[model samples]
Target: MGALLNQTCYLCSNTKNSIVFVENGIDIVRCSNCGHVFSTYEQEEHYEGYWDDDSSYDLGWWDHAHREIYQDFIKRFLTAPSGKILDVGCGLGFLLSEFKIKNPVGKPRVTKYPKKRFNLPGIKTD
Candidate 1:
């Protein structure tokens, strides 16, 4: 096992942690207090792996693939009128786009730093 990070757990802020596994060079650790599993790999501000030289990033395939599940989740849990929604690690914002279509007036606010810009129209990232 690689060296376990001395960082505190993001969920419970506990200093005690155990190495779960390592994937592709990143250490996946589990918090002793909250049992929340996360990677210790620090990501760059602007990740370019999703946006390569080809047009794969602009294919819009993820939207179609995840449409049914996103719709179901929206219908089931998002019935409440006064509630805040936060989509973390929201790659390509497909779920957010679906939510906007379902709730035209309500806008999903972005909390995490955008790894890539949203190509989908109508959904505002601000």
Candidate 2:
């Protein structure tokens, strides 16, 4: 039996009926009650590999999408006169770059994974 078969549902924390979803050699189980989905331990390796692949890390396509969303978020969330804004989980620093360009008068800081440096110019990492 797979690990999911013995585990409780992730949504409602119930130990009752659950549904399994399998795609691209990955397996995830969902709770029927609250509709929460979780992957089994065996699927973690495959999921990590999929994300860690260099091709997956390519940010060209993601940059365009993120830029639009980031702009909208900034317009909606930022209302202070002038303050420091720190962005976390900033993949490739594209959002930070956009924020800086849009808000030249405000202070915007970006935080990223130490090993994953963005290819954009003028992004400083240590």
Candidate 3:
């Protein structure tokens, strides 16, 4: 847990927010102005390969059922899911691999957003 600070909604920068839910002691608040949902605690940068650490195995991540549910949602919502789909914050490239399998017509490239926003894959310019 990190130090709690006065957090304004990043989307609307609105201070008017109320706690909607609390997960792992972090308050998830919803901005009254733009209806943006975010956490109260700031994200602490852990060491490299931090997310891969399953020290808290009870959390039960990497659940294929959840992934399938999301894929089904994508299939239902996004019709033209062709071409390349960018998987920003693609931890361990699991979702990207799944995308490659699900949407073989599309290419998925994983990259960390903002800082290293553009890592263009090798494409035939011709």
Candidate 4:
């Protein structure tokens, strides 16, 4: 178990004003400083080798219903898709895949801080 970094809220950086929303099963803490909710506590050794494989994520992210929802967001927010689309924390590349289908010419750029787990390079968006 990796030591859970639960000292302060990521947004407001306040340690004194936290309330544990769940105390028994898993400590889900909500920071009063910024009203940000976070899950507290993780295994001290966070890295469980091989278990974090991309295929493992694929199974969980198989809910294709999100494609419609993401399409709705694209229709509402993005304009023409001329520039590179930046997808922050692009988990499993579902949204990016949709974007690629919508914009064939524009490049899709994905980013994840610290380390990126997976990259859906050359996605067959069509």
- In terms of TM-score, the best-performing candidate is 1
Candidate 2 has a TM-score of 0.35
Instruction: Please count the clashing residue pairs in each candidate, in the order shown.
Output: 0, 0, 0, 7
Rank the candidate models, highest TM-score first: 1, 4, 3, 2
| Residue 39 displacement (Å), model 3 | 1.4
lDDT of 1 at 14: 77
Candidate 2 per-residue lDDT over residues 44-126, each given as its tens digit: 34444343435546567877777789878777777566634655342555666655422221112232222244433444432
Best by lDDT: 1
**CA RMSD (A), model 1:** 7.3
Q: What TM-score fits each model?
A: 0.44, 0.35, 0.37, 0.41
Global Cα RMSD, each model: 7.3, 10.7, 10.1, 9.5
lDDT of 1 at 2: 65
State how far residue 38 of model 3 sits from its true place (Å): 1.2
Clashing pairs in 4: 1-43, 1-44, 1-45, 2-43, 2-44, 2-45, 3-44
Compared with the true structure, all predictions reach lDDT values of 0.58, 0.50, 0.51, 0.51
**Model 3 lDDT tens row, 1-126:** 433454687545679987888778888888999997877875444334453334454323664546787677567755575644544342544444435333221112212221122222322111
Error of 4 at 113 (Å): 9.0
Name the candidate, 1 or 2, with the larger lDDT value.
Answer: 1
